[model samples]
Target: MQVSSLNEVKIYSLSCGKSLPEWLSDRKKRALQKKDVDVRRRIELIQDFEMPTVCTTIKVSKDGQYILATGTYKPRVRCYDTYQLSLKFERCLDSEVVTFEILSDDYSKIVFLHNDRYIEFHSQSGFYYKTRIPKFGRDFSYHYPSCDLYFVGASSEVYRLNLEQGRYLNPLQTDAAENNVCDINSVHGLFATGTIEGRVECWDPRTRNRVGLLDCALNSVTADSEINSLPTISALKFNGALTMAVGTTTGQGKIFTSLEPEHDLNDVCLYPNSGMLLTANETPKMGIYYIPFSKPVLSSSLNQSLPPAFL
Candidate 1:
């Protein structure tokens, strides 16, 4: 997906308008103030994988070489090389997997969520360790790579997991809700967590603290008034360069930017623009959230007005 001019967010000629669902047409039309946002998809695949199991969650790694897919059907975590789009490794877990990730820059190690009850960290060959979190968890993220600490967004509160001690530590509590944590996405210094509610939260990894929060209620706020209600965030990704793509379970998406400094690498031919943040929903039933968007999150004064995925 080609990002438009400097700091501008033009939905790359992605899927056509007919791709959006019928229910979203009126609500989407009224929300996006502009006329149809022209999108031309260079590549398109409607139904991706064939499985008796449905997708639990999808993720890309820090090094950007692999796509980690985890799900039910006596669920297992499978790793796939990004460019080759071929299966790299598949570990058959005794239980259904809810979330999975490749934590190393070399993609040497794996971390995963099992039944949202157990946390497992394994070597490439699946010879590794497992931790049964005391509380139930929906999703998890590893921060401060050198350390064994992981941010666990449980159904109620967020707990810090230390692999060194193999238990919970420094548990900073949230409101009284256990089934809140929906998805967790992290970059190097920062991370974001989504909930079953309309809230998307940001955090500081160093201090294990909350930074800020955004209410994505579809009807809360619009250009003039609130547009849509709280959107159910399905996926969250930190696509390096300090930007995140927030995918909702509903047929929609959003880009969250990082307020950080940029480097002037005059030595290279690379045109430094804002980071790339792209996401998608089931509207088109793509079953993949790896769509590309090179535009930076904060680089835009450009209000996003794009065509629906399936019209």
Candidate 2:
């Protein structure tokens, strides 16, 4: 409950009205409630505000202007203004929104992927267009420089979807496994995918050829199921043109540049305008790594060799 100065960090805590301790004295509870009331008076309070349904996913626009959130039961995306903290817009979806992304360069356009379909919409306006994928895609990444193109990973192929054209360009075949997550290195014009086979594949944008691979450590089996020997990648992200991070179902993680060994990383991301990488796992812990555009010195051990890109 201790926090540093505002110059160092700012923190906010929300209450769901769920009491943790079943035996707090009435006087102690009243004192805590009074403290919260005093703190609320100093803040802009939006009392009794509620969404139509439980929110499933929430995200902020890249520019930090708008907040986008989706509901668990309702097929919709709602936009809120950060300055006013007021709901600005809400668009209906054909199905439950699986995930969404606001284009890094064009914050006005948002691409939403659902369980069976995907749609592109203007953040201020309504729906712009919608399309069906050849196969249901679970995750996607946008091409940076072009800003109008993105790649969707399906079961065994990667499909390039150009929002400008409103159709898929071509499918890049991969090892016969489902692609878990894909990330683009726009500076290098390359994209990487973490596959069900527990390997990371780096691709050539123009030719759609496999240019490199990062294999996960499966040297020892720990479970009774043989599937444990094959790590399924749960997350993949490129820090920049030269650095990548991969997290596997086996709770293992690796940094592509040095092929360093890490563990319990379920997801990884690079800060938009900072020399930092973020990772988290089901352990519910997060780690931050600093990178000055070179191979970072991780505390983890280095063992396996990676494809040409790692070296």
Candidate 3:
């Protein structure tokens, strides 16, 4: 999507800091004001009232047609059409949105995981269903084959919610102190979890076994110096085969080759089709790097093709 200027983007205003009833009343008043006005005049009025805030999380739809973002003050989720760069709709939430997953390509099914342990299901029209988990969730991954939603949190267990059965199954136990983020490999169906103790653990959902582990801190340390503290694994993304991108609290972005940008990364995303790696740090701007995978690097240990060097 090409955005030339900020003024070209339209974000609907929620009138933050107001109660739900008051906000609804204000919206009704606006609707009534535009009821008899000319269509062109109403469009001009809407173009004048745009409120931009800090977005906590943002995700592009599978079909690349829409963008979903969550922001605070009074927590709200907004959907924007890529072609128009205009707000399609916005929904206010009871609590802050920790993360969300779009289940369908047409923006039909969505699941929002809140900081208060509440999971809300939303349809294209509006809210559909709701449930609660046991602990505060950090991240989640959807396994399409088994139709299970795996949630990891501040605890050592990964909670499994079966969307097909409409209930949660048994939680998967991990050896880490806390699970930070999880990602499922699209090709081989292997899911990996990044832990607070600086380790990435790979698992097989079919067998429920811990297949492999990578110690980030240990691998990062030079032969001459020792690490004072273990950097927390904050974000993870699997691109192709078993190739993964990892981000840490120490401002390290790794895919075999380490990159220290000196800012703690909030998230990392890989666009394998375009060979682009996107990393969001604590700063206002984001970093986009190119991954040169002309021929995948071979690893003697794993005997598989690894992700190539970054540029």
Candidate 4:
């Protein structure tokens, strides 16, 4: 989507702790105030970094305070301060970092996945523990505040790992066939998995069962070649307790409210606490999008009546 001006973009600052209702009412007031202001500014270019190796995974912390990134060919993980946009620290690992996770509840510890094992390291103390697993997975999401428990997606199955016990609790079942899980995300007590066939499923971690599902595949007969080939999901995330977003390998993506896709997306990061969405991608050019949530429509009757998928 092309943005005509910065005025077309609205970023509501919800940093101060406010209830959803209060936040929405405040946003509506602001929108009414800016409705006629014909001011526009060019989008400013931010700092850019040239990586030495292929950056495989990138994620922002739950509180949106820090950013954690790693590469496939490198054995090191880097931490960046979000506000300053400066490098904070880096730590080398024993093996190549396939994928890594920063616990939202506790950013002090991080977990990394190697060939067939996982390693846990403290932000300050360094390597604390490691475990050998039976299967390898692409992504992992923490189980609430339990630093030692998390979920891993491998193929079509989701495995719950008890880090303290060094064993899996039970495998969660998915309905998709030959569902090779490509990516996984967890937030707001919900777990979501994206598959190679371009489908997404949001599950309830407590029940270890599917709560909602989304089929992101384009209409085959009406889609062009590019749309048809872009069916493998490379990334996925939930915007808040309601909306969800997914990015595909073909450099395409979508944002969803309920089962119907609403907006095109790229590499997306949803901040539930802050009510903001950040999207980035590498295509003809590299760019980043910052979208702030307006609390006014968030609780609208139409939105509330949409579906469980939207909820």
Candidate 5:
């Protein structure tokens, strides 16, 4: 979708013509309103969030009222109002967005990490501030209690950017050769990173010390395979509790609960409330699995019947 640059934030308003109401009868007005509602419902059912090019990352706000996503070919961030089932606004960016985080429930504040090591901050009005990291970042997590942004990349050290102080603090050191993704536990404030060596390291942000380590490759290996053959981590997420979900480049995902292997796994997301797991891969459809302690069950693919508009 075409969007204005940071300097050209636009305001959209709706106004009524003086004779518009008188021109339509009450029955016709009701029919038009009903048609509008039906169209909106169809769009919501299809979940038609689109981008001109490939979508890099997507996130839902804390309140579950908005969705923030980034797309390429002239990078842009689009915010959608889920409650209204419409695009709220979109802003063009200079660099491709690697990953992004929503900093507020209302989505007034957002942070975008670019591929060129640049970190940008945007407010509700427009571009707010920006900075750069020393290395190309893969993923980042925000620790709400300390207001610290932890960024991980293809290096052992995790860069800490203090949003409150607006400066870089000492980096968190790791023994792993490279870090691919990071997340913070909302329930207990534990910082976790998924390394390229197929290990998940847990840390305590308060003490800046490594508390635990999980060798995912070892746990996932079959009797015939070796640990060194597993691929690097491609996705990682925390369930706000003890469980952490890890996905590998080869489409293998391991969590407190396990899932059958697929192909070219892209990302994994968990819905604790519904005891469900959603996985996106290199295919046109997504996978939904029922999360069970014993062998998890593959529910279905997201290839459902669509309205004619989608066709």
Candidate 6:
């Protein structure tokens, strides 16, 4: 793999657009022996917060110092040390937490949104920004380089939150008019919002305008008895250049890297930096992925069928 020097992390990765093929002989040897993993890694369930709740969203700080988990329960927000998973802090909320987002470039503050129409920004110790939401729903972020606050979601509004200005922008007539905005992601000046209708739209955060729309809504025609698809758009992110990706609630995420007049998917990301597309529906798992495409990309090793989890 043509990796760049360590001094500059010029995408030091495992492979390229494809992946390095697995060693078929090595797999045969392992099958003969029926060897098992030597080390026993325990899955520790964190139990610092009182009420048991599933984390709908989780964010790790850029410096890898802390983690934030948000959910609906007694203690809505939980903070942990990234290194040891030690409980750092916790907060109880009056309403069920619908979303929790870390809205800082340097992990300085965290923002939690409630179903009761409220938004609060917090530091590690105390609250910094607290206001009632105009409506209820998921909000996407408008990322800025150095600042802490960004735009958030609502049932029928787009919020422009700030620390210094201490004011909110006039509600940018949002898509909550017809579809329930499920999730949002932003990079640079572009932001994308997903809807329960299975559609995703890209918006210019600076202009508060819809730039492009992807028709992912499930549709059935007159002669069809069965529903064709439940096109759920769960997550969105910027890839290379004008490229982007959309992950479904079903965990099958696909990438589109072209702007041609056709719906052609360029690649898929399963393993981080591997660029090996995953088309499986079994095991029910989650993974991180990145596209460090440079040159001399390696071929996928699925012939030997290496384990699909982290190496």
Q: In candidate 1, residue 129 scores what lDDT?
A: 77
Clashing pairs in 4: 24-295
- What are the candidates' C-alpha RMSDs? 13.0, 9.1, 10.8, 11.8, 12.4, 12.5
Worst 10 residues of 1 by lDDT: 261-270
Cα lDDT tens digits for candidate 2, 1-311 = 21122323222222113232338787776777677754333322222123454454555567665656665445666666756756676677768776677774334777777777555455445677666777777777877554435445567888776655555677788884678778787578787888777777888877768898776535323444345356677766565556665666665433334212134433343444443443432221223344453233331222322221000
lDDT of candidate 6 over 194-308, digit per residue (tens):
6655666666666768787776544312243344456455555554445554555443322222111112221222433334222211111211222354222322322211111
lDDT of 3 at 74: 71
lDDT for predicted candidate 5 compared with the true structure: 0.67
Reference-based TM-score of each model? 0.56, 0.65, 0.69, 0.58, 0.70, 0.57
What's the candidate order when arranged by decreasing lDDT?
5, 3, 2, 4, 1, 6
Check candidate 2 and list the clashing pairs. none
| Every candidate's lDDT | 0.49, 0.56, 0.66, 0.51, 0.67, 0.46
Regions of model 5 farther than 4 Å from truth: 1-48, 225-228, 253-311
Please give, for residues 1-311, the per-residue lDDT of candidate 5 as tens digits.
11112223221111101112347898886676576653223212114345665555666678777767676657888777867867889899999887888888878989999999999999889898889999889999999998999999978999999988878999999988889988898999999998988888999999999999988766666775544466667666665376666666554432222333334544444433444334433443333444332123222211111100000
**TM-score for candidate 2, residues paired by index:** 0.65
lDDT of 1 by residue, 1-311 (tens): 33333234343322223333346677674555254453222333322322344445555666676655554465666666756656677666777665565667645677767765777777755648777776766666665453444444444567777665565677655443443333343445665666667566776666768887766545334565433554565555454544554555453434332211122110111012423222222221223212135434333422332111100
Looking at candidate 2, the ten consecutive residues that score lowest on lDDT are 302-311
Q: Residue-pair clashes per candidate, as listed? A: 22, 0, 0, 1, 0, 6
Q: Candidate 3 regions off by >4 Å?
A: 1-52, 223-228, 253-311
Segments in model 1 whose C-alpha atoms lie over 4 Å from true places: 1-53, 82-85, 145-154, 176-188, 222-311
CA shift of 133, model 2, Å? 0.3
Predicted structure with the largest TM-score when compared to the true one: 5
Report lDDT (Cα) of residue 292, candidate 3.
Answer: 49
Off by over 4 Å in 4: 1-51, 63-65, 72-74, 82-86, 104-106, 115-117, 145-154, 164-166, 177-188, 218-230, 250-311
**Model 6: residues >4 Å from true position, as ranges?**
1-53, 105-107, 145-156, 174-176, 179-187, 218-232, 248-311
